[model samples]
Target chain A: MRNKEKTYNEIVQTAYVMFSEKGFDQTSLSSIASEIGISKPAIYYYFKSKDELIKYLFDKIVQEIQSLTSVELETITTTNFKQNLYQLGEAAISHQEKDVHFNHLFNQYMLLASRDTYYSERLLKIQQDFLNTFYDLLTYAVKINAIKDENILIKSQLLALVFDNITNFILTDMKLDYKKIWIEAVDSVLSGVEHHEQ
Target chain B: MRNKEKTYNEIVQTAYVMFSEKGFDQTSLSSIASEIGISKPAIYYYFKSKDELIKYLFDKIVQEIQSLTSVELETITTTNFKQNLYQLGEAAISHQEKDVHFNHLFNQYMLLASRDTYYSERLLKIQQDFLNTFYDLLTYAVKINAIKDENILIKSQLLALVFDNITNFILTDMKLDYKKIWIEAVDSVLSGVEHHEQ
Candidate 1:
């Protein structure tokens, strides 16, 4: 069992590198097996086909990203909402800084999403989860009488869009101070809610 | 001369259809020529290769999009700033509504941008132009005493990010009332500057 799992991991890792370099369509299972010194049949034992391999790889990538930067409700407080968001932005920046090829991988994934329902659903889930995090933060702020907003849904959705946009820029390797940009952008949106008494 | 121009246009239009349906990498000059009932060398006479064809196509796409939805400085008034923005958002929504394959072509172009400097520079120009439009709008608003903010640069950047994000969602075929969302999101960000006198 240990040997089987090791081979599976090696195949996945090799495939990731190849896909990132050559893109999903251009990379082949034969190429991955040759790169890993594994038999082609061995990969089939792990993943039925290239499609299955990509799906599995995508799920793993999303899980890694979620663990790295997703908001934790328990760590946030009503009064320090802006501070907590700043931390979220910082985590995002660090993730990008650590991985130079992440932007290419992400753009490739987005292209896949445009073609496949499975990828599009995954993309939507990420967007939905981001919006939900904002909804929870806003709810906590309202519960503590820290802010006022009649359109929480739209506000959270907008915040999620703004956050995703900035992150997209960071992922695309744009030469900008993303952390500063995120803070300034968040401040502009949050300021409207920050001072409202009712 | 007229026949030459007609054949050139046919090749471009046919390539556009094939590329939109099958993506850039999967589509080929031979396939495009066959589709248009022309010889492969005829396409070569107009475009040197697939790379050259794609570059030309991308340029045309950008030009078309710019003409469709880009903000016109002459159409704006300092007093009705938000209304002018709303009109801009409306033009964006209408553009998406008109073309279903635009999002896929855009995703393909973005994927190309990741691997090629030419595409990335084009993408940057679009983003920079968007940011500049916001700067112009905000400058006008401030000149007429319609809004006030010390961080116009950051504000314009954030607004551009938000606008681009919302348009991305629309292009990706997200089922939502985008115009309503655009208005609400813009309202939240703009409200911060609208009420501040200094």
Candidate 2:
């Protein structure tokens, strides 16, 4: 049983890499099985179909991101909201770097989900959860006077978009140092030009 | 000659709709031709291949956006910098709305360009022009004290990302009132948060 579970994870990881490198349409179940040194039948036994494999992988990644957000939010002890928000942004960037497949999978999944109803609901739920977590954090920060209180939904959506763009920019264009640009951008958001009055 | 130009334009427009609706991979030259009431051979006459057709459409869209930005920037008076910047954002959002296929084409083109050197260069140049245009505008706005003076590159990139996200959000999931949200967001950036004075 343990061996079967390990093989299942290994197959998913291999699929992630192949999908990132070749995109969803170009990557195939047969290619994944070949890369994993397993037979087509073995992959079928584990994932049933390519769509199923993609859906499962998408769910797993979303779950992992949610867990990370939850952990970070729960551990905040400092009253400095800028530092806290910076930490969240850094965590997101680090996670994307570690999982190179995250951005590709996200783009692919979103593109596919837009056309197909099967994936849309699942994707929407994941998106809503992400938005809600950020909204809650922003709300908390505002309550504590850590960050300015404003349109929580709009600001949350904007923040999410900023991170998404940063990730997509890095993945699509390899010329720029995305990490440096992202850090600088986040700092600008945290500290505006207005001098704080004592 | 005029008739031929009209037919060619119709073919490209039809192809854009079909490609955005069904995706580039699933769309075919024959489908576009049929949608435009033209023969496959006729489409071949205008665009040697499906790839060429796609490239032409992508370039056309990029050029249109660039021209719009140029026209808007040229009309901006230094005295009304905030209003000018807001108008620019509005123009971008309106342009994006008018070209529903822009996001679809951009996403498809990016994916294809990632694999092809020729298309990749064209795509990069178009993207760079868009970023540079906004960077210049932000720099001007800072010089006029219309907005906060900060890192032009970083601020411009963040603004670009915000606009991209707004477009994506409108295109993908949300059906909210974009005009209101966009105006408010732009205003917030222009007026900025009233910082606690030291």
Candidate 3:
């Protein structure tokens, strides 16, 4: 039983590297097993197919994002909420920016998610998690009287758009002009979230 | 010669509908030929393969966008700059939004664009065209003293971001919240373009 668990995790680790490097379509289960020195049938016993492996990877990414962002958000003080927000924004973009191959694999999954309902719901869950995270963070600021009673739900969604969409859009092209666009977007979002006196 | 051109155009039109309906992977040359009542070889004579046909359809979409937006942009007088921008934005989004199947095909092409440099350049041209159109319109307002000497380049790019990005994002799901987000984004964009006193 212990050996079985070891082999399962080993397969997951091997498949993640293979999938990120070769992309989902190009990387096969046989290739994954071959790289791990396991039989193809043995790999299938763990992941069923590449589809299941990708689904596991999606969950892993979401968990990683949640944990990583949660750690960052917890450090936000009332005195530096705005500054922290900018820092968090930079961190999020840079996190994805640093990993080119993983970005490619991640992007391909986004395209596939639209075509498959199972993936679509998984994507929706990731989006909902992000929105909820941002909402709760801002709500904390509001509760502590650090910020005004802002319409945070809308702000969160729009800010997520600014964060995720711009980050995703500028993934491939990181020219100065593109970076300017991204920074301009995040700055605009930060300012927009401020409680303006009407 | 005239008859040959007519047949070619008819094939193009038929393939567009079929490709959008069935997606590129599922839609084959034989299927297109059967739908158009032409021999498979004749279709192949015009287009080497599905790749050429897809390329042709992309060019056709670009032409349609230019003609469509040119007519809209020409009507933007100084008095109605903001409202006209709204109208133009809505027009562009609704134009693509009207055809659901085409959005799938168009989005598939976008995914492909990231993988293939040739398609990437074509997609970049579309983005540049949109930016140029917005830049020209905003520049007109600036030249005529309708607005301040705004950073038209950044404004144009950001507004184009709001226009095209939001337009593309809302293609799949036009829920009430999504519409609100789109309007929220555009409104923020318009307000952000204003010359703020330092």
Candidate 4:
């Protein structure tokens, strides 16, 4: 059982790198096994196929991300709401930066989500969770009079889109100051932009 | 020459629906050929393989979109810049609504672009073109004294992110009023948001 667990981790880690670099269709079970110095049967003992391997990776990543950044509802106050929310987005970006080739994994997942109903549903759940988090914060902001006149529901959804899309700049290899872009948009939307009619 | 052109269009149109519905990997050349009521060899006569067919489809779609929406810079001004820019975004959304299964097709392309240097480079050119359009309009806004901003380039890039992310809500089947969302963000950023500090 112990050895089997080690082998499982190896296969999944290898699949993550391969799938990130090569995509799902092009990456084969044989290549994964070869990279890990194991036979195809060894990978099969844990994951039945490439689809199964990817599914496992997806579920595990989701779980890890959720647990790592789960927030307590009772803890958020008006004063800290913006900071807390910003922290959450930062945590997500940092996790991607530190560990898994998260941007590539996410780009790969977008392809899968478009075709596979399973992935589509899985992604929706994660997005809904994030949207709700933004909604709750925006609701709190409205309560304290931080932002006004905006439909919180639509605003939340839009903010979620804005936040989620920040990571996409990485894929193009463009020399983008992503931090500035991310901060400017998120801050202005949440705290309300200081604007004037000239 | 005419028959060859007809055959090429037939293969591309058929591939479009299959690739959107079934994804690039699952949509085999045999499947596309059979669906088009043509033999496998006929598909090869126009294209080499599934990869070549997809590349051709991608290039064709990019060219079609570019030609369909090429903008004239001479007409934009301070007063009409916001509306003109808003119109550009609407054109993109409506084009997706009318012709291409754009959300699905774009999702598929993201996956392909992540791994394939060729597709990645191709997409960058398209994106750069779009980015330049946004930058140009924003620069015009600044010159005409419409938008007051510290960094036009970064603001333009961030605005592009905000606008581009709007289409993403479609993929989840969420009943979002995307046009409203798109316009609100663009307008606020372009025409300074009406702000009152308490």
| Shift in Å, residue B155, candidate 4 | 2.0
lDDT of 2 at B162: 68
Clashing pairs in 2: A196-B198, A197-B196, A197-B197, A197-B198, A198-B198
The ten-residue window of minimal lDDT in model 4 chain B covers: B188-197
DockQ result, candidate 2: 0.38
- How closely does chain A match the true chain A in each prediction, as TM-score? 0.84, 0.80, 0.73, 0.83
Docking class of 3: acceptable
Clashes of 2: 5
Stretches of model 4 off by over 4 angstroms after superposition: A68-70, A191-198, B65-70, B191-198
Residue range B37-130, candidate 2, lDDT tens digits: 7788998888888878878888777777668766345555556665665676677778778877788767877777767777788778877877
Cα lDDT of model 3 by residue, A1-198, tens digit: 999998999898887777765556667788888888888999778777667888988888767767756635566777777666666667766776676555556655666666677767776666667767778877877876556665666656666566665555564362426455555654555465565556
* Candidate with more favorable, higher TM-score: 1 or 2: 1
- Per-residue lDDT of model 4, residues A22-123, tens digit only: 777888889988999999888878877767788888887788656854677567765676677677667766665676476677666766776688988888
| Range of the 10 consecutive residues with the lowest summed lDDT in candidate 1 chain A | A188-197
Model 1 steric clash total:
0
- Estimate, for each residue in A54-122, the C-alpha lDDT of model 1 and write its tens digit: 888888888876675466666566667778878877877787677756656766777777667888888
What tier of docking accuracy does candidate 2 attain? acceptable
lDDT agreement with native, every candidate: 0.76, 0.70, 0.68, 0.73
Instruction: Report the lDDT tens digits of candidate 4 across residue range B11-106.
Output: 889988898888888888888899988988898888777788888778877887577446676787766767787787787677666754666776
